[model samples]
Target: MKLKLILSILFVATCFVALGQEKSPEKGLIKISIMYPYSEGKTFNMEYYETKHMPMVASFLGANLVKYTIEKGLSSGIPNQPLPYLAIGTFYVKSLSEYQAAVAPQRDAFRADFKNYTDVTPVILVSEVVK
Candidate 1:
């Protein structure tokens, strides 16, 4: 009776502790991507995005930033279809918390710089690598 209750309590406590532990990233990395979907009349400046925006992001993110990659969309599945996205920029970070902490401080500055490259708003995705 009492032993059963004690065991139940212990089990619950163990679960709580496990849940509180930090989540590990896939291959020690968490990837954050920002995508700009193509639209008529939408404009993107690839040169500014490559030369300026990424370097600024790296500078602000600092040590937490593992690396970043930028992709230029060429085409969609159909032979002559327009690309789904104008560009996709991915940021690989050490961990979710580290990335959050690093970006929080510089978020405003980061967002402000977007106008220099493109007019389209980006869709952001954060994914955990599964290895």
Candidate 2:
């Protein structure tokens, strides 16, 4: 009886682990944070980023835009740092590699087109789902 119980426990544990692995959420989401710096006398660049650049990226990437936000910073208490405007784009996916394959072409096209405007480099950070 003890032997049977031990074997059953082990089998249950193994099944749980396998099921957990298959449901891993880290393979499903992405977030990109865009930092728009304080460019003196060129505020149009910000608008350009919003109107021209962003729409192109969104249409091209074809990924679900979970949330896009602008984070405004404070200047007075933040030392000498210029208060940069930020745009965050969240992407959800089924697999990381799939996400990459989907976005690569659009990224290349955006890079090429970005030369016509100011250097607006984006920092990409990704995450997955849970449960």
Candidate 3:
């Protein structure tokens, strides 16, 4: 009876360990970050980005967009170095194809809105989520 109880406890513990493990994100997961570099005398209106641009992006992209986050870059680690970017915006989506399809139609609208927010040309990075 003691042997049986020990085996049962071991089985339950193994199950719990497996359940607690972090599963990889779904296979098609993609993340895109648009980074606006900082320059002296340049302007980045964080208020416009949060209030106008993001809402427009959400409305334009609709279901293809899983979620998004915006970050304002404050300073570089070095005391005197200028910040590398004024702002960064990240978009999480299910797949590249889905994102492309959704944005293609609204491309013009997105471009037009950029002039309203910042003058810095954004550097874009697209990455697949692994692990």
Candidate 4:
């Protein structure tokens, strides 16, 4: 009756308000990474870095740390070759200009922190979608 109709309307209104509140991520290049050859031996150091370092860097660059993915197997020679762990993070921006500007300071921080974990330098490569 009347009560049922009023409840339905309230539910629909509430759903709309909830959906509207979600923030849309800006269109830009998200920092995707493939941090590989993680030391299987230095389990403790690696774990610490993953937990502590990544969030600090992500916050500095005004970016969202999307996920940490463990890469495995080779496409060309999956039978023999094994892929390494690849951790992914993202920087949402209106354009590359903003993205680049944000990371410059944080880059040095990453380098310094990363030296403790592995000898190889971490490199940042950029990619733009073409369609």
Candidate 5:
């Protein structure tokens, strides 16, 4: 019937409008992602990173850090393909300035600890999370 068709059109239009709305990023929250790309002859000690390095970093971050996560790369999408990254570490903080202030004084300590873990240079990204 015409009523059924009209309702269907209205439902579709409502869905479109809902989907078009953009999600706003969380206020005063910053995400720092540290990624280590995979390469030939590169070495990564996951145990050292997870057990020692991250904990040290967390201690420095202190109350500013909300939470953190570590991810170990296994393989690429294609079967038998090499992984794109050796590892990834992400942490969330309440304030970017606070996080920076916390790490600035200890930058050298972090660099020195790197030699104890991996030779791969890490890529860092600061991002805002939207949901």
Candidate 6:
């Protein structure tokens, strides 16, 4: 009985250790998040953003971009509260420098296209994915 209990404890401890282990981070990868904050009188054209804006941005990133995701905020955790953001767009690139090199020339084009989609200024964040 003691031996069985010891074995069970060992198995459980091993399982816990495995479960608690953090996932290895993706090295040398950069994540760029473009967030549009929610506010009164702000204008966001979801259709234009999804169809036109994002695709244009992706084209600029080209081979450097691994993938991209777009999210639309519905509502806050509180009841009857306003949504925190109108939309969010995130793209993962192999490196920050590569992404910058790719987008530098097209920065003006990007800014020019923004008026077609949204009135609110976007918040940009660049971060490393460290698990």
Number of the top candidate by TM-score?
Answer: 3
Sliding window of 10 residues with minimal summed lDDT for model 2:
85-94
Q: On TM-score, who's better, 3 or 6?
A: 3
The alpha-carbon lDDT assigned to residue 9 of candidate 1 equals 100
Tell me the tens digit of each residue's lDDT in model 1 across 1-119: 99999999999999999987747554758899999999989999999999999877877777778889999998898988888999999999877887788779888988898888888
Q: What lDDT does each candidate get?
A: 0.87, 0.58, 0.87, 0.52, 0.91, 0.90
Off by over 4 Å in 4: 1-29, 37-44, 63-77, 84-94, 129-131
TM-score of each candidate? 0.75, 0.50, 0.78, 0.50, 0.76, 0.78
- What stretches of model 2 exceed 4 Å from their correct place? 1-29, 36-44, 70-77, 84-95, 127-131
Residue pairs with colliding backbones in model 2 are none
For model 2, residues 29-101, the per-residue Cα lDDT tens digits are: 5555555445555332446666776667666445455444444434535677765543343444445575577
> For residues 1-131, what per-residue lDDT tens digits would candidate 4 score against the true structure?
99999999999999999988865443333445534443444222456455676656556545333333333323333555533433333333345566567667677777777666555434445664231
Query: Model 3, 1-131: lDDT tens per residue?
Result: 99999999999999999988959654457988999999999999999999999888777666778888999999997999989999999888887787888788888988899999998899999998775
Candidate 4 vs candidate 5: which has greater lDDT? 5
**Pairs of residues clashing in candidate 1:** none
Per-residue lDDT of 18-118 in model 5, one digit per residue for the tens?
A: 88784554544799999999998999999999999998998988888988999999988788888999999998898899999999999999989999999
Residue 114 of model 6: what lDDT? 89
The 10 consecutive residues of candidate 1 with the worst lDDT sum are: 19-28
lDDT of 5 at 97: 93
Residue 14 miss distance in model 2 (angstroms): 39
User: What's the best-to-worst order under TM-score?
Assistant: 3, 6, 5, 1, 4, 2
